[model samples]
Target: MVTLEQSQPKAGERAYAQLLDEIQSGALPAGTVLAEMEQAARLHVSRTPLREALRRLVADGLVVQQSPRVTVVAPIDAHDIRALFEMRRALEESAARIAAERGDAARFAALADELTAARLDGETGRDAYYDLISRFDVELDRAVANDYIASALRTVRAHLVRVRRMARDRPERLTASVAEHLLIARALAARDGDLAAHATHVHLHNALASILANLENEGSA
Candidate 1:
């Protein structure tokens, strides 16, 4: 006896998903005020559900409560990006090392081939490239098999979407990233934990450098 209400997502959950997507996609850019009544209307939800959604976003650090009645999207700057990379480096490096030792070598070898042949020319190609990376991440997570580290990585990845959008225009960085990922995948395929870890570190270092440089360029522009 499953009722429609039970089968469908709750209003709060739906609102939260929509708001989270908008925030991450920059549709609701940082520092944009989230008025209760207005957002409820815009999202077509009641005030209570919208409040529930806002609370979740606050916990996620995607929004900030300015007062009892005011909330705004969180701002990301160079400092925030650096802190994010600091956490990412710690988590991803360890994950790569563990996965290299325990993961399916054949699967990683296939991923290495995919990375080697990836195309990132236009917007469509870029989307496909990102999809390939997502698949690689899925495999890495499955190989690592650590809930705690995976949970932390999920949080870091949420913010990373916004950060990635900032540097999406830099074709050079994208090209280098493909090479970096190829090295990591090859290391994992070879079951070389040290090499996987070191490759992950270098990849993160280069990625952070490129992102920061892009931010500086934008600021100067």
Candidate 2:
């Protein structure tokens, strides 16, 4: 996981980013208690800004305030994963259809080429692969040209970042995911709306299965 840097001018945003990074990276795992005084000191910010940061995280569903002073990271389980994917499937499938119809073919084709060339043989490659996916997401949102869908996708991506970390240790899943994304990228490049949507559906299905299996394995271990 990338280290989050502190921003002196915007303490609240910096705290929020740092905490969010820690939460997503499992450095601050689910159900970990976040005390105001402790976290404020730990994050090296004032209580007021730390409180603001915690409130933002609360709104993001990454943290929950149990009382005036007690806050904890939200739990991640089968139910949460399932619900998240259900919405992801709906939103992404629709986005794929619209993007295929209106998106930049050359851009998606370039992305497909990038995926095809991605090695994923080492940490640097893996980081590059994830960055490629981020670029693809940006292109999709741009192609769809819908503010509402983009906003909703941002929300889903936030949760997905945490879930994705759970499966990152699996090399097999990582390879398969790259292949799956290549297919979706190709379908989008071809401007085949149905094919693009179907490819996205399949990718999400495989992704969810991999994530759940990883979670179960960790639980058993």
Candidate 3:
């Protein structure tokens, strides 16, 4: 979705973003070789910028260097997903508690209303729901007012893209997720720290189970 012209000033950063998006979207699936020269030509960037981008992806754990000359997209599976959820549960539970204590009730109430009305019929609806989630994250971060927590969340979120995509398209799960989010938002609006934290924990627990089940189903298929 990124344009080359918009990436003129910082081509390396642009390349990183574009490549990361592709990997997360499963366009470049696990173990896809990222030949430097080939990618550079394809992305219309020079070798140096492409290498810089690869290095960033490596640091992000989205790509790995098999050798000096070979790079490939990293694999995703059950163990990795569980590890991610462990950390996500810790951070999100703590964040929800803090946000409940300090966040503006009106803001979270508004977000709850938005979630209540969210539609997940198709790609556009799904994208809109994600945007709403992003807005909720921004508000939660703002409410928490912790630089370190926010930084850690940004890192966790980057990897979550692939995990979420792998979670597959289940209408029931999508509907349940919106309901879970609504409960968390309403708890925050009520300034109920314990309820907010509990709601967040429950939501993450359900999400992890759903993703694991989906992965198992895929493997069986």
Candidate 4:
């Protein structure tokens, strides 16, 4: 196993974030091999630490390890997309409810700010939308104030990043998606648990519908 001597980060945590960032950005697209030795050298860490990082990603549903190869991001199909969004609908609805009840205005405000910034960037043909969505997810989870719920949603989000990109990458859809996010943020800001949960569920259902339509169109064409 590769290991790193870097003191600035918790070995496993640092490796996890770095690798996960690459995965979410599609830098390491699904089905790409992650050579432990290569990553260890590239990341300037030890094999021991790098292996630990891979394990963390495995737990997060970001990668799959098969013998004879270190690990690779798992390939997802159409079914995976539907299942992922279904999971998202359930977990996000619950998170939105908890956030409205337990989370503070400041956190909700920050989420709104992130969405606003991303919307502006996306309008101008910039690609900061993904980053902003990530920030929103984090803030929303923090608002929930429950680690278990946060972890579950985080795992689901990890798997959906690429598929969501498939749905959110279009210029028109990207803008509309951000608008939808703002609606949820507003509801949470007002501390309306019922409103927040309902908005979130409805939004996810719509997004899921879009994804399914897009994928079906792709398959048939």
Best by lDDT: 1
lDDT of 4 at 107: 77
Q: What RMSD does each model have against the real structure?
A: 1.9, 4.4, 3.3, 3.7
TM-score of 1: 0.94
List, residue by residue over 124-202, the lDDT tens digit for candidate 3: 9988998899899999999999999998898888889898886548888988999999999999999999999999999
Model 4, runs deviating above 4 Å? 1-12, 68-70, 106-118, 121-132
lDDT of 2 by residue, 116-157 (tens): 899887889888988999999999999999999999998889
Q: What C-alpha lDDT values do all the predictions have?
A: 0.93, 0.91, 0.92, 0.78
User: How do the residues 77-158 of candidate 1 rate in per-residue lDDT, one tens digit apiece?
Assistant: 9999999999999999999999998899999999999998999989998999989998999999999999998889988888
Model 2 alpha-carbon miss at residue 168, Å: 0.9
Cα RMSD, model 2? 4.4
TM-scores, each model vs. reference: 0.94, 0.93, 0.93, 0.80
Model 1, 186: alpha-carbon shift in Å? 0.9
Indicate the TM-score of model 2. 0.93
Candidate 2: count of backbone clashes, pairs at least 3 residues apart or interchain: 0
Supply candidate 4's per-residue lDDT for 64: 90
Candidate 4 on 1-221: residue-level lDDT in tens? 54335542476677888888888778888899999889988887777878889988888778998775768888877788878878888888888888888778777777787777664444344457666667777777777778888878767877776776677556666677888888888888888889888888878877877888887888899
Q: Cα miss at 213, model 1 (Å)?
A: 0.7
